[model samples]
Target: MNTVEWSETLLLDFPPMDEVHHTFVDLLALAQAAPDETLPQAWSAVIDHTVRHFGNEDDWMRRTRFAAADNHIMQHKVVLNVMREGLGLARAGNMAAVREMAGELAVWFAKHTQTLDAALALHMRSVQSDAPARRTNRANEHPVSAP
Candidate 1:
C-alpha cells in the first residue's frame, strides 16, 4: 500500500490544521497496513477521519471566504463520495477496491494538501491575524466612561 508519509513539507504552520492532517496521515497508514480480515474496519476509520477533516476545512473556507473555496469544497465532496463507495465495496467483500483506493487517495492527498489546503491555511493565518486587531480596534472605539 502506498502510504502518505508525513513530513515537514506537508506541515502547514497552522497548528489546528496541522494536527488534523497528522491524524489523517496516521489513519491512512493504518488503513494501508490493515490485513484483509480487518481492512473494512480500517478503511472505515479513514473514511470517518476524512469526512470530519474535509467538513472542518470546508467550514473554515466558508467562514473565511477563502478565494478557492468552491473548488476545494467540490473536491472534498467528490473524494468523500468515492471513499464511501469504496467502503461499501469493502464491506461487500471487495477489499481489493479499498486497497487500490488507499493508494490513489495517498496521491490525491499530497496534491490536495499542496494546493487547496495550503491556500486555506494561508487564509486562516491571515484571518486570525486580523481578528485580534479588529477586536482591539472595537474595544478602543467603545471605551468605558469614567465611573
Candidate 2:
C-alpha cells in the first residue's frame, strides 16, 4: 500500500484547499521514501510546503470568519512545532527519531483533515455561495479569481 494516500474522504471539497491538502500528502510519501542520509532534506521540503499551506488556510479561515478559526490555527502551530523538533533531531543524525516523527505526522495529518478541515470546508460552503477559485498549475501564474 502507498505510505501516504489521498482519498476523496480527505478532500475538503474546496478546490484550492484540496489541492494543497493533496500536495501535503504527496510530500509525506516523498519524505518516507527518501534515503536515510537524505531524509532531512526531504523533511525540510515538507516543512516548507506545510508552513505555506497552513498559512494560506489559516488566513482564509480568519478572513472568512470561520467559527473554528482559532482552534484550527492553534492546531497548525502545534504541527509546525512538532515538525521543527523532528527536523532538529534529524539534522543531528537521529534517523530513527525522524522516522518515528514522520509516522506520527502521517497519522496526525489524516485525522486532522478528516475532522478540522472537513468542518472548515462545510462551514465555508455554508457561508459563501460561490466556491473558491481553483489553483493554477503554474507557480508564477496569477489566480484568475479570488476566494
Candidate 3:
C-alpha cells in the first residue's frame, strides 16, 4: 500500500490545481494511516474534498470547452461514485475496503494528474491567456446597471 505524498513530480505548475492536489494527497495519507476508529472520518473527509476537487475540474472543462470534457467528467463521476460506495462500506465496519480504496486512489490520482489533469491544465493556461481580453469585451458590451 503506497502512501501518497506531495512531491515535485506532483506539481502541475498550476497553483490552484496543485494546491487542491496537495490537499487531496494529504487527506489520503491521513486516511491511509489513520487508526481504525478514525478511518471513517478521515475517509469521509477525502470523499468531501474529492467531490469539490472533481467539481472544479469538471466546471473548468465545461467552461473551457475541452475536447475530451465528457470523457474526463465521466471518469470523475465514476471514481467519485466508487469512493462514495467505499464510504458506505467503511461506515458498515468494512475498514479493509476503505483501506483498499485509499490505495487504489493513490494509484488513480497519480495517473489522473499526470494525464487528464495535465491536459486540462494546459487548456486552462491557454484560456487564461485570453481571459482578460474576453472579460474586458464582455464588460464593454454589457455595462453594469446601477442599482
Predicted structure with the largest TM-score when compared to the true one: 1
Runs with alpha carbons beyond 4 Å of true place in candidate 3: 135-147
In order, what is each prediction's RMSD in angstroms?
A: 5.0, 7.1, 3.7
TM-score list, all predictions: 0.91, 0.84, 0.91
- How does model 2 fare in lDDT? 0.84
lDDT of 1 at 77: 98
For each candidate, the alpha-carbon lDDT, in order, equals 0.87, 0.84, 0.88
How does model 1 fare in lDDT? 0.87
Q: Which stretches of candidate 1 lie over 4 Å from their true place?
A: 139-147
Instruction: Show where candidate 2 strays beyond 4 Å.
Output: 130-146
What TM-score does model 2 achieve against the real structure? 0.84
lDDT tens digits by residue: candidate 2, 20-69: 99999898888988889899999999999999999998987887788899
Q: If the candidates were sorted by their lDDT against the true structure, best first, what order would they fall in?
A: 3, 1, 2
